[model samples]
Target: MNNEEYVFAPDDFVLAGNDHDAFIDDTYFKQSYWKDMLSRFTKNKGAVVGLFVIFLIILMAIIGPGLNEYTYDFQTISHQNLAPRIELLEPLGIFDGSETMSTSTGMVEINKYVSEDGSLTGLEDTYYWFGTDVLGRDIFTRTWEGTRISLYIALVAVAVDMLFGMSYGLISGYFGGRVDMVMQRISEIINGIPTLVMVTLLIIVMKPGLGTITLALAIRGWIGMSRIARAQVLKLKEQEFILATKTLGAKDFFIIFKEILPNIFGQLIIMSMFSVPNAIFTEAFLAFVGLGVPQPLASLGSLISDAFKSFTTHPYMIIFPVIVLALIMLSFNLLADGMRDAFDPKMKEM
Candidate 1:
């Protein structure tokens, strides 16, 4: 009814220049799988902190032993059981080279700088950041050296086990039927034996050193990885892409490694991360039981074992190594959890 004053003017409409280009430019960019996984991983605060802590520990493990003048095995009976002292932190009353002893008058705090006669011992300038062990060796230096050994053992064991597991699982799953059956039975038999028992037997048979420990771990370590890889292969083998690859006459090896492995590699990597902590803990346990690396070559477990006897008198002896071991285990677990969440598509949805 009021159409008399309304008229469409050409000036009211503006030409939209480069609207297609704008749409194209504003479209979301596609990211690669690893890039997406990394983006998700970085979003986890706990995981990021764990990664940073692990990096710091690794850096310290590499350089910490050399920071102080004293070698790990350097002994001085006069310096035995000296409390942790640092020149920088002493002014704050902590790490002031003090030790508490149970005397006839109950507990008495004594300055490391003072001798039995209560006079200056002339060692005020001396510092042992983690004090000294019963053998008068530097605990700080030994701790780092021990960390290095523990890490080495864990990494090497895990690497060896992963290689075996991945290969076994791929072959077993790829060639199903009798091949799968035989492989599964063999793995089951190996897995039936308790890991501790295997390790013990190996220690009894061979020398209880790094190689023995590594071999013992490898014996049963691959079972879990093999199972995981097998399951993944089973699941993926029936997928359309795999069927297509097979139809295309791809070689079995090519199909397994190139087509299938790349698909399941992320899961395998996650499993490997989970296995690291177990390997580390196992090595530490063996070391604690007097089956670890021999003398002059310390591991975190051996260090803890050495400190256990004097723990009642010098609690510091055990504290440092235990703390380091705990941190390493915790950080790896957190990082593994983060990786699992990041790489898993189902978790991404959650």
Candidate 2:
């Protein structure tokens, strides 16, 4: 065609210099709600640090027990009531060669039971890094071991909530009639009794141990999750997509599990996060009251209970467990808060 004949018409579509199409809008990233939520969550410095702390605690719980030479139950009166000592710190002049810790009562040292001549009376091979209990069990090993048990209980409790509780509420609320009323009534009956009283009764009947503690926590644990799930399902079931799926002949189970469950995962997960710390605390309390794991099988609460006798003399025993429990509970709280902010649109707006 001649150049003059090829003159652009008024309605001719003109191309930019580049041939590639720019179909994606420049504002797409800005409009992404999920991406912006994540950015906002990461900006919360406390949450990020809390996440890191949790990772370290988990790592310690997994690997720390094995690294120490002493077993959690290993005990000897010969080396009883030793104090925390870092050999490396000795070289730095921060700690002397002796295992001595400054306490509110007085300066406490390792009770090696030396004679007046200054010779080792206890077994020479064993070393207590974080000190020892009255029974001479290694505190460092016991601490990590207790951490393992506590984390395990929390994990199992959270799983019970997410699995059974989530399913129960989904089924009940989706059905929305007799099933809902019956299921909700059951949950309410369980909720009617105080957790402490029910757990106490269960403990007496079932025999107090790790298994009993886990069972009690799980039995009551799902109540919160079920309530949350029911509310979420109540809202979700009213949406147009859910109505459309029902009209399309989707089975109740399929609709609830496949469609509804995935949509409410964020809320469910947030509930699970909050549940973990609560479960951990309950286990600790049960153990403290002598209804948790039996003797020789250390847990954070049991360790604290054991220390109660000589707590004034050997406060480190109480202090260490308290610190670990505090760390775990606080970390989960921060993580839950972060996740809520990251997943909830309303929080992202703030």
Candidate 3:
């Protein structure tokens, strides 16, 4: 058959013209990348649970200590080393246990009474929920307080690291040639030095305090983040969007910060999430080894160290703090994993 004779009818299939307005209208109603990411994150049970746990920890750290009248400064020589008070649940009795007889105004009475020995004489005995530390301070209270320190240090250190690392990485990555080579070499030299040795040297020279410790950690911690960010920028800088921006004569700063940085922000956020746990661990270790925050301000590591001597008798002190620390670390790690999955381009490809 001739080609002309075999032509198909226009009605065989409908044609949808490329209506830019229709496409624009559809896109206007579509969910953004952040919204989709949020939906995906919400569906991740582990991440949701981790976020809940972290929120609870933060809430406890912020509010729990305030519930107590003793502000870690309430002291009594008489109460030192005193065991936690144990109160028993009394069995229900007939007549609602009302044994009130008289009062100063007229004649009022109550079933509960204080003993001459000062023990809770009217109630039955119960176990201490968290027991007590070596100094007889409530382990439960101290644990929450210590949690605040841990989370605070982690957050501050991560912030400092990110600020320095991101700036250095972006500048080096965008500039590439000599600047990149110099910065990368410097990073390598710093990374070559043992982290512990550098930390120890700083502690010795700077006189150990929370600020000094944080600063020391920030120095070593930024290297890995910088390298990761630089690598990301190198790959992203060659993309079409970046090239277009350059072609339009956009300023270097504008292209780097406005275009490139925003695109790689997910990776930066994931890296920061991972960095927090590391900073917390580093602070804890430094404190444990006497190179951490100063005295009177109790960190989990410091509390654990203090409880070491009486660990046999007051194991609760160490146990409680360790549990809190572990929970914080675990939650951070889970959150990091979630972020990694959320940000991973490979997953999107799949």
**Leading candidate by TM-score:** 1
Ten contiguous residues minimizing lDDT sum, candidate 1:
19-28
- Please state the error at residue 336 of candidate 2 in Å: 0.9
Reference-based TM-score, model 3: 0.77
Total backbone collisions, model 1: 0
lDDT of 1 at 69: 93
Q: In model 2, how large is the Cα lDDT of residue 128?
A: 61
Give one digit per residue, the lDDT tens place, for model 3 in 1-350: 55665668989888778865666666566677888778778777787888889999999899877765455434434233333333332233432223334446865534332344667753333223344554545555666777888988888867865788888899999999998999999988988987678878887788777778777767778887888789889999889988899999999999988998888888888888888888888878878887776766678888778777766544445777788888888898888777777766464353
* lDDT: worst 10-residue window of model 2: 90-99
Q: Identify the runs in model 3 with alpha carbons over 4 angstroms from their true place.
A: 1-30, 73-129, 345-350
Whose TM-score is higher: candidate 1's or candidate 2's? 1
What residue runs in model 2 are displaced by over 4 Å at the alpha carbon? 1-38, 93-126, 347-350
Cα lDDT over the full model 1: 0.87
Q: Name the best candidate (by lDDT).
A: 1
lDDT of each: 0.87, 0.82, 0.73
- Which tens-of-lDDT digit does each residue in 1-350 have in candidate 1? 76778788999988888755555544555668779889989998888998998999999999999998988778888888999998999889999889898868899888766577767887967888999998789999999999998788668756865689998999999899999999999999998998778878887898878888888877788888999899889988889998998899999999999999988888888888888888899889989988888887889999999999998889999999999999999998898888888889584463
